[model samples]
Target chain A: MSQKILTRMGDGERLAMDAQEIRDDIRRGTAEAARRAGVPELTEAEQEELFAILAEPGRIVSVEPGREVIVTDDGCSMSFYSGQDGGGVGAPLSRLQAVLTYERACGADTTSMGHSDYSYKPVKPIINFEANDYYNISQVTTAPFLYGAQPNMGLYFQPDGPCANAAELMPLGKIDEARAAQEEACEHLRRDLVFVGRRLAEVGLEGLNFDTCGSAGDADYLAALQAVEELKKDLPDLPIIMGGAGEFVLGMHGGVEYQGRRLAGLYPHEQVKVAEAAGVDIYGVAVSTATTESVAWNLARAVTFVKAASEASSIPVHANVGMGVCGVPMMEQPPIDAVTRVSKALVQIGKADGL
Target chain B: MSEALFQASVDAVVRGDAKKAEELARQGLAEGIEPLVLINQAFVPGINQVGEMFGAGKLFLPELIMSAKAMQAATDIINAAIPEGNAQEGRGRFVIGTVEGDVHDIGKTIVVALLKANGFEVLDLGRDVPTDRLIEEADKFNAHIIGTSALLTTTMPAQQKLEEALKKAGLKGRFKTMVGGAPVTERWAKKIGADGFAEDAGAAVVVAKQLLATN
Candidate 1:
């Protein structure tokens, strides 16, 4: 009911502020709701900084070339957007700079180029454009590069990047060109993966993560899976974590509805199926808590969805829970308690799944 | 043969083949089937089945959207055959869009399809639409209801701004305003002074009809 704090901020500033504020709000509300619902909340320290728990020192297993390594520690991960979280393409500038800053402020086990950072733009690779200099580092690195957490880099490989409209991706030119366009998209992604991987490895990065839910259809989704598999072939030692939809919103804070009924917005199970085929180490369900129902209610719903996903899959499952309201024409950060409750529920589900 | 043509029309939509659905519609028209009857018999039933299957989780988004697209294609062909002056009186006009600063449109698109299927004439303004533009379009279309969707907290304020803009333009009560999206709760709709709020696309139709009755 409060006037949105976002209305007063500049475009980029408002996006970052809104995302953080909504996150803060969800965290706060979820914490309180957990108390009422008899669900445990994150510890104060964990609440203060999530990556502290995620970035705990673990023995590094050497990843041999041409052999794939499974990431046992999925770790508590947060998926962010560049413009919304600050930094990246369409944002103020260097997303890696912002990532380092964020890690310094809040410990981060994984450095991910939020969906906004790598939204596929035709004829341009945002990663190369944004993180041009730090693509590769000369020495192997460990934790505390920018923050308290050990660093692992994650980027997105959307078949149709969130920025690229699906209609545009629909083949319009000559038949062969359209076929070539699809192949070109897959090739571009394969190259992007290799490019980012080599660049991060040069800087001593330990692992890789892929958020692959925004793209539609079996073909695009399967293509993304193949790209991940191909990338793994090239970097067998790097622990690869794959993310897809767990439910309707995929926690992207975008509208995902069909008919009067709310459809599972993303193909979580299908994505996991391909990911399993691709030998992805960890599968993440990105469920947003921005439903019209109470955050507790949505968390409960997410529990059911994640449980089904975990039960149906052979891999370790993690829930990328966030507070994104997709129904309202506009919204602000959800209460912080809501975020914590969803986090707690995710943690519960993760444990139940034996992750 | 008539039954076969109608069944094929239904099959085309269920299969989400837009070209085939359009083709079947043309074939049905050539066979002297009434346009409205084709819509009522085949198009409506096809979309309804899609809705049922989708609700039951047998069908997912790709199929659901394709079916909707197929329905639209058939509807377009049917509408073109009907004379312009043959208007259905009392069916409400609904103008809908995703609020500015939020470019997500799946929810709005679904709502548009549902509205059209339920007999409302719609002007879908697409996504990231400005508040003023929605009001402008609503007025231009003489809409009975203006539905706004916002997918992000950052863009949600635009819904409130739209409500305020309508009041400022002294046209607040002229159109019934409904607000929805991922973050929108009934409480937020009430806070924003919206006339109605539906949690999802199905409820939207029921609520839109209710709002029209009172209006």
Candidate 2:
């Protein structure tokens, strides 16, 4: 269930909590703890205390069928929807929800679903991050109406833990088990999409974006794509967006000569031919300057890839920055500025309308 | 003749044929080729090349996995034939795992393979390992370095917890600490008292080696 907790108190009243304020408090707490440790590092005790403060959102004061009020022990109460936003689960999703709500308030046109680094939460069972699943949608109930933007669910295909460890285990002749795990993951992706689609519709979400790190074999990719195609039948109203690195997408289509070298992938034009045939609504090209030595070069490269994808696809195309190259807590004081610059360039130069 | 056989062993791994790689190792043994030669000259070189191909996007996970299997098949046979302590000589013992509350292990698994390929005696504790488990394993293995990977920003603090746990247990400075993951930054590592942080597998191997130097 999605539930929001009131964290801070105002002048004898509760104020609407802000994601940035929460982050700032955590950062300041960590820094102060580090300073008190006298070694420029936070002690484990201090670290745990900080994380607890970050993760804990106080206690429930009142509860109804769909909404509730959660009050900190300090007497500050935050009213939230218990069933819509992931209120009681923990701080990660709640914090992310607050951020998305803030972004919508700031006139952002698109609310990209999923976290920067995507992992299938149920498949691994170890990752408990907030940007995890559709059930976390209670946090963004008003995004569609607020921003006039369709919510996009960015589905991650890679499975971690034993499933991902299959690659390592295979070298030791442990193929069957890992292969079965991989297959199980594909099946999970297949089955979950339908449930996720139904749940998103309940929350009024309208778009589906496919995302993968491109480590899976061709068979795994095929299985995921087939699952997607099947889900499309059920949710034909939802537009689908195909997203990944340029090389992997092109390779899946055919082969392409990149930088005078024939890589094992199709050229941009040829790739779009396959995408259009598969009924892709939009093509998202991951453009990053992580490999480039300078900011100007990175922007230039981002523009080049975005333009290429826009021209290649008959449908709308968008840009995903670096495809998880940059680390998390990305929407912050500094990185947010970079995101603003790059996003503007993407829309202006690439002739893209959304991100 | 021995050089030709060793070269064939490399080819077997590059081609990702487990049966062929195992057969070549047995063949080299029968032909009186040094087991060390089979590992250093044949298996290591092939896996290294595979890592390069993977980084460059020329190779996918399937091929990389197959090559690792080929390399392992040969390495297992050669390791069994060689003296136990001899195989570990000149290599530092490294223990790694994903911290508690985070189960992401793909990146950690890659780092393990690269560390093993680079001559480190790597003990992968797998994902969702608690701080106590890591500490216990490090003690059991007499590890020179302990590493943690946390893919979620929420779990990233566990790295710091592990560091603090080490200090509380009087094990601080006894083992070098390394932290990494998609959400991990160099600043975070420094704040948490980590000896090193790597962005990916290749950089991880380099950082692990550098940490060993300081340790």
Candidate 3:
């Protein structure tokens, strides 16, 4: 009864239609109408005109099977969870950097993942700015992500908020109701979605992220799926990601913290596979259950799982290892230390001798 | 119940057992171990580790929050018992809330829990709290600290307005003010005439105490 879309494009293509090289081809497609209606590129006026012509590539309408793009955001308000890479005023700075770096490395687009300080996006007066101009500008104003559609969970839940109104989140808890919680979370999610979507159109955001969709799984995974799907209907050109695994992984529910490690219920990963079956392009695997070992090992497992899952449909997979709160369960970024860096180099290097 | 019952009790909390944590906390007195020792040494420490994990980024929000609730059940039982006597007190009384036009409580709730564990008497006004309501509660409780939260970029100015109103109402110099949440910064606090700023609740307890000591 439900519909599904294929994730891979013809013959494993990777951004063959870039902005600078094939302006006319990009401008003539579905990306064009969306471009004209989206945010403007900051540095270029000529390109801004052309941006309106590009058909945004990641049309993530729902969890329905299809070509999937992803966006990653590390919530700054909840910076308490960022582990070794965190602490102080630098939390947001690190989070944005992670977003940019993660997106670049993992290859996601259409991001509304973390704090929005516009570190990369500068605010210039729209001079010769026409209110009635026919053209749209898509520029990479900030990091390639946005955190909340409305209330960043970073601000709302993290003890360090300039926060969103609480009543707005009444829906996240009411997940048992159909479209209620998803619709509720979407109240904020939508606000950010539109703002970020418009910004993506302006910043030339080609892919999209629907990461928050799966967060309400216990309450209702289908609701989460439908929420992102409905959102995709509104935003047909971006990839949508939906995944959540924090509680089950950490063993808060009478769980045993054994041998200095946290473990998870058996079914959460199954839920992830279901999200994929429900038509999602990307699946998030929380391998942090290996809290005894380290975040990298879990990340490697998660990446391996994604590599396996996405291999068949040809969808690109993204692995999420969020920041640590108390700094104990370390999720190293950019692999700072030599030990970490050397291992990370091996990961990226692809085992020349063995392979 | 014998001490063997308590070993299971201790193991349950140590293992992050939700059902067993409550059962163990309820059985602490019957098992002959002093309630305060269980509260301070075992149960509180379990959550403290959870908090440390939260602070260290080894855990995320859903886990931290669930652990907080699980830990609270054990502490709730301990709080009901006869004092095990002789213990160091937590930090002092503090009041926190989101400014008007905001309706988020996650940040406020976290700070309250963090401060409570750290020994602060916290009066949480909940979300969308009015400045006058905050001031009234602060005055009623003779609070030494007041922390305000605002999430919206549109409403961040409410923090300034709260300070100005506090000043106009002649309460500005009376209490220390701390502002936090996403839109706030240490610089923003200085500009708004807030006494201090902490980015998260764990750090908030420390900052609130330090500000209270100076004031």
Candidate 4:
């Protein structure tokens, strides 16, 4: 790892969450839901609100549509606090297949609004808010507009290769052609962060999902955080959902090599904590199918992490086991037995533990 | 007896033991394994297992891909050694590809294996195939079935383009066309005038067979 990539192996003893914890939390959620008399699973809207309470149970918030949010064809505008998910609203996405498709749909058709007053609807949609995750809020806010299968400029100008390393990124470093390629990539992300910030700020978002960055180590992480910061500047109320480094680091990297823990190496817990300390609306880890199931142990560890992060963070945390990993898609076709077992265990253990 | 060897071959392929899979297949051959017997017994069940596992999520894309490769290895040996006039000889020629802009192919690969296993001579065009080229290939091969897959919502239009190109080229009735993918509903396939449609690989062969007979 680069010196520039600072890590915080802090004594926060907040070490990683375990499978049992996740199973317990899941059970708790089920029991709580059962007591409520057939609310069934929590909706995406409800989960976001629950996270807000978890992130800072001290404050009040919501995720449903409301007066503070302004919807439009160009974009949606919101000015309310947001948190992350609570449960399986859309069949948990860890892969790009589901995420990319859903993100596109959410961006195209969805909008939100909210305030402390809470007028139109009872509780506002509790969207997750991660503020300190990047430098430019605008780039992240506008990211959806530029990316996805939808006809955004990112695709329009993109030269058809890796989104993170397209030659189209070169213009950002016009002044320094030698490092122009790298700088261009940075610039593109920075712009996307700003876009994300702008759109989200409209929804009172100072945070991000942090799942799609596809980066690791300090530099990539810092660049990502810097982009968040930039967006936060324009939208000061931003929050963040930090380091969804599912699959791999979710179990402390490769579990066995590190004595049945995620490798303490290069994982960015310290940076995320720093963001949390800075009053990020949300801060916690996340896992995906790839992160959770590269080994059977991963699936077990992921349940633990989801439980831990959900309860631990002052902000809402959740898991996203979408449909694909890198290119090897999975979510749509996990074994029936695995789904049954995982779901049962999560409800029995991870959910019951109250983390 | 051949059925037992075929079943063993499928088990070996699933376990990722290539040597074992090949040995079982060779054993079936020495026992005078009929191509169709091997296909129906070992290959179809094996690929069907892929479908079941995929549906259940026990296996992911890589596993599907790996199994397809494994099945192909076994198919090459089995198809060649068997006589040509076998009743189950797969001569219902089909050309398949992913629609433009969508590179996802795990679904298509399974369909390819099943199609070949079913005694259909399949021309797999791989992923992100353009519309015109798809039409060109089907016309070139005089294929009985022209298949298209679009995993992304945006690229689904290519399926329609394939249909239109065939109509424009006067090859409309020449090939029975089918389209598939996660987002591709059969209603959409019908709306776009596809001869057939399937949500998964196993059903694709069934649909392809029905489409060929209908055409």
Candidate 5:
């Protein structure tokens, strides 16, 4: 019999379950989510492949070196805080240098200037578009020197800042006021994205990532969708990677709609259709982990969601796997065993084009 | 007539109408209804129902937040009318913030709202708060628990620093410490000697209550 696979729960508890049991859980978990989402379930061959991958007796696993897929990261922060203290203490030139070091070491396909406050709202005030043509122009101009050979280098931000402000209104029973605020914030966010996209494009930036879209619910998602639509019209060739904060939209605004579909309660399969409609070049799918559940369970569920999303999407599918989502343990540094297995499952079985 | 008013109070909260909930609360006060009676019979049930629906996935974050706001608006009025000395007895005091160098406040904000709905007196220090400031404010508030949240790996050290600072001050035993965030795990909590670890807002409440009960 294959050795019993060791894994950890979402909360970091150790579990050593029979290989067959883990395979069974993977099938059962994936089927249940597929049924609920009205997406196609995995075929028997795909299930068997996932089982084989998990049953392998290795401390860590990876795709065959020649068969490796593209790897990209959102909010790449390692280079941002290169100094001894916790804060972002490094200068721009040194930070870019660190990105170069990380790229060569880790073999990431692309690198980003990870902002602690990675949102357009906070960066808006600092960006004097009229005077300098870009916010943080120093970093924007210098990134090309280090990353000249890379096909893509761009800006990333979450549409989360305004969502927080709108949520504040809901408590005072200011529902209408909150809704109006979200609408206004959406417009402002779209304008900021356009301004930044245009400025970055002028300096050879090739992509933009709307990381963690819809974290504040429907309105937040709407803002990102609209921004992508606007950005596509301005720069048709620019690739936009739209990643979600959760598997399903939270319905925070509860009643907002986009392109006639309700923005609230949208699962990955449903979410990708809207993203594609808005001209998203790459759809980043995420499934949150249940801390009490085992990694096998979370990985199976994440695969199920990602596979459905990949099938339904016309755009490339990038699976977000790290920390708390995509079957990785919810910790600062995830164990390599879980990470490798999840990555392999997503690419081979879930049909993910990138990670 | 009184029964109808109480039902209306519950409905106002379910509807997430803070102004209506506040209005009904004032009306109840004017009619000589006991403050505690209004809270126990009306607002608590309303917020409880909201929490239940949220867990069931029938409600989402906005609906839940609005309901909590409505419940708070009514409860604040009712709480003030209670006898001063009897007020806030046994209800734990919680001091919460996103630690310094981290601006992610959504998770911390949700915890604050839920804690308030669950009857804890919460002092929200907001985001990017320094470690020393958290201790100082918690001490001033006589807080029973101090919760720190850090969303980034770099900022997570702030939580460990908070733990060290509390020990250095010789106040470790006095205040129960809770740590949470997207990147935070139970292992980190134990490694840093934190008293409690919550994976999300719902778990935060349970861990907090258990921590208080144990001590």
Candidate 6:
């Protein structure tokens, strides 16, 4: 006699629904996503295994002792100074602190030195392309590398924020102007990323994480792909991790295309192909949680998408399991119950290489 | 004849042609059409359709932003001709920003455009704005509501701080507070004592209206 499992709404409401219904929905959603992505659907046995994990009555669920996988994180913070901006620690110290904690305390296999300048547009003033006066990338990456952590440098391509604002293209109804401005911004961002990538290579940075790629839609995705392609030309051995900001590529520049493929509305399976073409080593998949739906519903949908993407990809697929996405609830601190269940599903059903 | 011009106004907004929308608005005004009538009958319907299409996944962010821009451009012109005291009579004023240390603003930007389309005088303080500045602007603008957005878990404390600061300043009763962002949940809004929370721009408009009505 299986008991009803507890689930959560996207808005954080707790509800108890029949476990069988949840399983059925997961199967249906997963099959549809797999069919749409033109990838292999989860086998009947895999679906049953996923249902058992989701239906567990425990407060949290985890993989058995030896089935653990590699772990990576984006926007690793400096927790030294709580409530203070940048943790009151300089770049070098912050990077050191984050890597130390993730490696020794959290037992993370790899850590990231995530640097965000609010928006990429503002980086122009702070970055001296001609010299190393602006960014301390080499120093920051070197410390983590020497400390025995597989360190990756993460940056965001949030083109919608500053890029769209600066162009003022929307207000004046200048669609072409907006598209052209985004294209120009892409060039500047590509140069900046390549410059940073070179600095990382100088220090033998383990990997490069284009964290939150395509948040501003297709234009943002294009920028990251262009940068990765250029960097691979010079530093072929350098591994690149491209993490998506959402589950789909928004047609912000609805008409924009990359490698002759229109990018306005692409799912994760389709997105992986473009990332592979751009020479990305690892592809991170993000599936947004629908706040109005049950956690069971969200998890099923997320795994379905990830499963298709994983099967279709030639490279390792790392599922992004964080706040408000990948079946995790949208909260400052997502409940451990949901996180564990989501992590377990991604590993068992989605067949992800990392989380 | 008037119906044809009105439909053209609607078509311009749907197509996201700011110049055409503006030109149609001017033409309507020159033809002795009432400014409010033109907005209410023509442009509002266009924006509303865009919002509906966006919610249904028929359009994307760039299209949505473009539509909002067209609506805004036409509204700016038509709104200017209305008499000073008669305009902004019952419609409320709103102040919004992304919380300090959170630089993401696409969500907030969309909310601002939608609020403006719905006839609210919105003041967007841009991204990474401090709590003090948000309150100060709200006070100066005589705002009935102050909305703050935070995209990260680390910066969510700022929303709680805003709630505390409003209480400490004894301005809590003067204005309603709304919170939003990718990581912001309705429970967090309640925990922080915020008056309202919205998941997206379309929902923000509804929440703002509810908040204003109570105020």
lDDT of each: 0.54, 0.54, 0.46, 0.46, 0.74, 0.74
lDDT of 6 by residue, B1-215 (tens): 88999899998988889899999999999999998898988898998887765543347666776777788889889889898876744667999999998777656766776777677878888778899999999999999999999877778899999999999999999989999887777878888899999977788888999999888
Q: Please give, for residues B177-201, the per-residue lDDT of candidate 1 as tens digits.
A: 9988866767678888999988777
Can you tell me which runs of candidate 4 are displaced by over 4 Å?
Answer: A1-159, A162-205, A211-239, A242-355, B1-6, B32-35, B100-130, B151-155, B201-206, B209-215
Residue B147 of model 3 has an lDDT of: 89
Distance from true position, residue A1, model 4, in Å? Answer: 70
**Residue A242 of model 3, lDDT score:** 52
**Model 6: runs farther than 4 Å from truth?**
A1-3, A9-51, A63-70, A75-181, A250-255, A290-293, B1-12, B17-49, B52-62, B69-92, B139-142, B165-174, B213-215
Global CA lDDT computed for model 6: 0.74
Number of the candidate with higher lDDT, 2 or 3? 2
Off by over 4 Å in 1: A1-198, A215-220, A246-270, A288-290, A294-296, A324-341, A349-355, B1-46, B55-57, B60-89
User: Higher DockQ: candidate 2 or 5?
Assistant: 5
DockQ for candidate 5: 0.23
Tell me the RMSD of model 3 versus the true structure. Answer: 18.0
Write out the backbone clash pairs for model 5: none
RMSD of each: 11.9, 15.0, 18.0, 16.8, 6.5, 6.6
Per-residue lDDT of B152 in model 1: 64
Q: Residue B151 error for model 5, in Å?
A: 1.0
In terms of lDDT, the poorest run of 10 residues in model 6 chain A is A146-155
Highest TM-score scorer: 5
Candidate 5 per-residue lDDT, tens place, A1-355, comes to 6667787777667678887788787787677667656677778887788777777779799987766777767645443554433234455545545566556656667665533345665455654442242234335432322111110001211233433355445544466776776666666666776676666666655567787787656677888888789889978987778888787876656777888988877889889999999998888888887776777778878888899898888888889885788887776556887788889999988989888
lDDT of 4 at B190: 76
Tens digit of per-residue lDDT, candidate 2, span B28-116: 88887788877888777787787776654455454556676677778778878887677634568999999998866666766776676
For DockQ, the strongest prediction is: 5
Error of 6 at A303 (Å): 1.9
- For A121-144, candidate 2 gives per-residue lDDT tens digits of 342232233224443553554433
For candidate 5 chain A, which ten residues in a row score worst on lDDT?
A145-154
